[model samples]
Target: MSPNRALQRNISFYDATNPQEALGGVVQNGSITEANFLDILGILLVVDGVSPLRAQGRMSNHIVSRRDVPLKTGVYNIYCDASIQISNEPWIQRLVSRFAYREKDTFRREISNRDRKCVISGIVNPESSIQAGNWAGFKAAHIFPLEREGHWIQYDYGRWITDMDDAPRSSKISSSQNGILLLAHVHQVFQQYLISVNPDDGYKVVVFDLDRFGLDGKILDPLCRSPDDPHHASDELLRWHFRQSVLANMRGAGEPIFEHDFPPETDMVGEILAGHYGQERFDLDITDRLR
Candidate 1:
């Protein structure tokens, strides 16, 4: 059987951090660690259900060594091991309600005006509906996530924000260029890193989880990508988000998947603190929400 087919057949047993443990029976020649294992898995995920030739052409730019190499070869050559390091970083997503920022309304308005729809689902927001004050089921999601504002500032990620006039002086994390309009459900998946747009692959939407929204392989909406539009979402930010998604879902054993829904009177904080990387995540969530 072909290597790809062999890997696919035993995908359930595959472990990202220790590939040799699971793939030893199938791939006997080389040392496959988390680095190469994730690279291979990423290619498989990107090319799943896609024709080889088409996927190759689409992922050409991601080729590390030879631009002419086959899609699989190129993907295997690229070092995706950085994702492993990223997965170990102190990143966290906020689950509880956050303190409202005064500038958030302006940020939402700017994003809604620029995108005018769910960029992933292509669901349009009609002007008539807006005039009637019926704006529901839509949200402006932060690509970098508000919970990571500390990291954003420390890393000076605000340098990528070209449209910053509307952002608050304290931080450019609220820039419209860092936001995207998405359906309420789509927003949830995106925040959880279950879905992402691969900018290098012609902005193709990649679903890391079950594609219940029929969004896999869909192109990002052009409305949010026009070069002439000053408020268009940043490709740099999109790329960062895509990498995060890959690490969260493709790394060995993958990052811990948290349950966001809480029952009434449940100790949400206590539960979160008791989960994986709980103390760090809880601390970050509390710090950002109160800011």
Candidate 2:
């Protein structure tokens, strides 16, 4: 199906107390207005994907409420439904990575030093291995994607990086405060927005896609969230990512899931220009490539 068509389906909401009574449908563009109770409920209900059976189950078990939605003022407990399959489209990945490109040595070194293990999984990299300069199976994942540097700059998101000295005010996208050490595979799912950490919810790990790694509902590592730790990841950045994940996976039919494995000789530029957000993606790609 086309990306636009895949995102046009309606997301319905029903009363949890009486599942038979319909509350309403999601607003246009799948945005759930914060002020509207039903809209908030609808976002909570469908953010994890459109599964009537699961939605019904949650309501039946009182796992979610209709009249008294327990969501905090700005906190959201959202995830993409496991059923919304991710696509194997490598061009989109290339385009996004191009925008994310920067001098990696500093960011990677600082993040790896601070977070010696995957923050979510707690898989520690041995000190000996690190001394040998072997950082296999782990990566520094950005909380606010580097691809969205334009958004970051426009909003002055660099102000949130209080932990870093000499951090670039123009773009703190590569700062350790905006990064988390994650297992390589976990990093992929994170970059895809299929999983995210909800800092407002005590940094609980929320999975929008299938829980293949059993990471759903896990709390973020304390080592990374300790208040005394100057290098802790930014709560603002985490919240931003959580919100982005909600918009990407819960809105409408959910954002297209693009794969990241591009074979050699693939016409990545052509594919990106032909896909959703084509012009924006192409422009970002070109601008970043030029730099």
Candidate 3:
């Protein structure tokens, strides 16, 4: 959502920092980073489950080449430290990396322990990648987001503990309750309000298309239910996410939404579904499949 820029500046527009400042660009040469060719909207744009990598190639200069470093057992394109935290490379911005490292260390591990793996990424062996911090392309993303009672809420959920013997409300705002481990691409779209996870009757994925671009779609259901952990995706949190991504915005708000949580599927009327060789409408020949 484009909040009135007149009211705020840096990072006010969704996960975007600033339209004028197309961050995340690393210049190969002094003259060109992908920043020269993009804006914030273009940076966050996704098409068919992938961001536009073609534009990145178009800006690549022949003179600017990357030096090859010796491989260090990388997985998920991340390398972890001994603490199972994804170690940050020099490339990540200092200010941002500081907080992210904390998130990577604690958030990733906590959610993995509770949910048992990356919920959205579906990595069966997420543990193997954790020790190496070379995760299998998953991110410990905040569900409610990092805004101050605006597009999202600015709650520091990192320090939340599972033992709710003291304060029950603390666990409610914890990332372990509302946050999720999504694939990098999935996290990107999620941060930008492109998709949401619905965890009611069954796990369901919802996508939003504000521009009518038909980018809306679904992936495999996340299917997470941690009975042991007090901090899995709460139904309240899921509805909040849906309201942000669907109901209050692009998709119809009045639409009766449910994650297949309604009453059990009913069989179609047997006689009406039956086929008849005779012209008489009531002369029915029901098959076992209809039973």
Best by lDDT: 1
lDDT, model 1, position 69: 24
In order of lDDT, best first, we have 1, 2, 3
- Alpha-carbon TM-score of each model against the true structure: 0.71, 0.69, 0.40
The TM-score leader among the candidates is 1
Which of the predicted structures, 1 or 2, would earn the higher TM-score when compared with the native? 1
Model 2: per-residue Cα lDDT over 24-90, one tens digit each: 3322221122223333343344333454322332323322334323222221222233332222222
- Give the lDDT of residue 45 in candidate 2: 45
lDDT for 281 (candidate 2) = 66
In TM-score terms, candidate 3 sits at 0.40
Could you give candidate 1's per-residue lDDT for residues 53-123 as a string of tens digits?
11111234332332322223222222222222222433345442333222388888888878888999999
User: Candidate 2: TM-score?
Assistant: 0.69
Least accurate 10 contiguous residues by lDDT in model 1: 23-32
TM-score of 1: 0.71
Off by over 4 Å in 3: 1-104, 125-127, 149-165, 168-172, 209-223, 247-291
